[model samples]
Target: MSHYWDNLSARTNGQHTSEEFESAAYRLVVEQVIYYADRHSRATYWLIEGFERDFREALAPLGITLDVNRQLRYVYAKPQYAKAGTASVAQTLLALVLRALYDEGARLGQFTDDGEVVCDLVELEEKYRLMTGRELPGKGEFSELMRTMKRWGIAKKSDESLVQRGDSDQTLPYAVIIRPAIADILGEMALLRLAQWKELDHMPRIEDTESEDDHEVTE
Candidate 1:
């Protein structure tokens, strides 16, 4: 692995140093995902794509799988196993809901130039109720949850400063831009489990909700 890292560190001749690889790997693991469209991570995204094999080999021993979505221009790590309580029910349910909403938007051809779905919280709330028969968490809790979503590359608030102080400001952003990475996180199996949430009244364990190749419920 060090050999590969050393090779990568030298790939750019004098333009980059070993620390470049170290920094990129650190972000890849710690941030969990990177997208070419993200201004902050664009260079790291390219570096990972350029030396994907090296990154994969290095991450493998840690039981992490690198999923590079070339068409979508993003990459994320999947842990082979999840620790107990890695995700609260709120987090897991919300992620599954976002994945479903992304699919729904794709089916309707509603996408931005970046292939992301944009919708206000009203829609998200309705969908959450339709799938889980429960209201969303409180505003502060929802806000905190979105921070995790952003960190994982799943979704994000379109306007970070657009929060409204009252319910009348529904048109204000409370808007979420669902990234393509959401599909990679939850996949079709999450949709199937939505039916279970309705019919069986069961909140799936993280182990049960994972798509076949991924098992981590995320933090």
Candidate 2:
């Protein structure tokens, strides 16, 4: 994470503001980007929370909404089309859809009446199968991955919930946006593919830095 932050800082030339950093965090995470914050400083928390706030804000313009339970500290995102008073939906549309599916389980009494909706593992796998038209993974493997995703906020569970079925407790609310963060880099790879397929120079060309020999000759 730290390495990624360093790269991001260099790319931005140290011009990123708190809000920008937060928004960037969302974009990075949504794109499955990894970065490390200043572990030794208070900056880490600021960066994490700021990014979350900015992420939620980003969804607002896209007509998405989110709801955070102050008491339970649960966060929920959904489309803003019909739900006007709900919170902003700054996450990608793919994420929004997954969250809604998780929400359905919440409304269906998966948790205690007051508990929030985390995603149901079984349902999540089923949804994944449907989306990709592929076979789902075994329960154990999928559940473990889900928990890890939840911890990272790459995917999240409800903060509070009453266990409905002993085993089937929560529901999933977000899609894992980036499948292969390295293999499928967001900007460069996507742009390059577009340029090739579209047969146009859509991608911006980056100039290479001067070599040591060139620098020495110039000096």
Candidate 3:
């Protein structure tokens, strides 16, 4: 028990007891990425910064490792043993599209002062066409994927209704706040591989020979 833990316990009336806090920390790493800008990330970040040894020790037995990027100001989990081909073709394509849009938004100074990049469905679709020479996912699939991305802290939609409707015209540029977590999700090596794939005009297919090492935690 550290002084920090003591203060946290006092603030939360022991509701965030050590066991409870550790469980919450582990859940955060497993379920959602921890970003400095996300309000919910504060507690997990505090736990990692203040009780890193305890946190790591607790997760070590589960074969999950914490990847803390100080420069990026975020944390995510990686399995010690690689899982095979976790990303479906649609998911991989969507991630690449988002990464491309993130880069474009940054280059155009479309990011907010707080460093969130905002992109709309229309822009995403156009970019997808340009990059892949293929149509974007159907509306239902696209909306579902967006919801999944939102859950994983990659992006946040401005209007839930617009997402549900899945009509780009009706939504008329529904903006998604792209968080810094995208960089961590895609990473440098993944992006390089995607670039190579694109140069070779390799269309993403379900049967594409993607190794576990080439895939990231899209699900």
Candidate 4:
């Protein structure tokens, strides 16, 4: 056996010979929603590309499926045994809002050739208000939510400190990069759930919503 296989075998106590690659693949998928060939570091992309088959085979045993979007140049994982409350109420709502904006942008042909939907905090807030018939969360809360979204690889902000200002001024536009990963995170079922939530007699108060920091992911 090769040195890599030998190390892997030793690590798995002879139960598996490819555990090393599998473990690495599992970590990469869980850490980020998408691994973009164009945006990710060369080494990171190469690692995923090189072990794509092993990655899928390993994850299959754990009920996690790997999805590689070649055209979009990214890879995402779908867990068969999905756990509830992986995202906070605020984060979930924000994702729905972003998904709504993305769909609207696509319908209006506003997306760039590369498939990115660029929007600002102001537009997002306006769309939220229109959709939910409620004011968007305060600057502090919205900023924190944006940080969580960015951490999860669903969105990116042009100005790191823009959200920290805590000003509700809609005129001050801060550019946000709405990544395609949003679609994967908030799939069809999630959207349906959001729609049902919106139809509730009383929507949950934004201030009372829990932060993403309080969430836990489990299989």
Please list the C-alpha lDDT of all candidates, in the order they appear. Answer: 0.79, 0.39, 0.66, 0.66
Poorly placed runs, candidate 1 (over 4 Å):
1-4, 81-85, 160-170, 199-219
| Model 2 TM-score, all chains together | 0.27
lDDT value, candidate 1, whole model = 0.79
Cα lDDT for residue 32, model 1? 83
Which lDDT tens digits does candidate 2 get at residues 1-219? 445445545665577644545454454334333323113323433444444554455556666554433332233344435421221111122233344444455457554333434444455567654543434556565456555443334454443433445565553443332211112112233222222322322233112324222111000
- In order of listing, the candidates' clash counts read 0, 21, 0, 0
Query: Ten-residue segment with the worst summed lDDT in candidate 4?
Result: 210-219
The candidates, ranked best first by TM-score, are: 1, 4, 3, 2
- For this target, which candidate reaches the highest lDDT against the unseen true structure? 1
In angstroms, what RMSD does candidate 3 have relative to the true structure?
6.0
Q: Give the TM-score of candidate 1.
A: 0.79
Q: List the residue pairs that clash in candidate 3.
A: none
Model 3, position 99: C-alpha lDDT score? 77
As for candidate 1, its clashing pairs are none
Candidate 3 TM-score versus the reference: 0.68
lDDT of 4: 0.66
Predicted candidate 4 versus true structure: per-residue lDDT over 1-219, tens digit per residue: 245545655755665555455555656656656555345434455555656775676667778888766666667777777776566656666777777777778788887655778887667778787775667789888889889878777776764424423455334547777877778877666556556545652855544567325443221
Model 2 is weakest, by summed lDDT over 10 consecutive residues, at 210-219
Worst 10-residue stretch by lDDT in candidate 1? 210-219
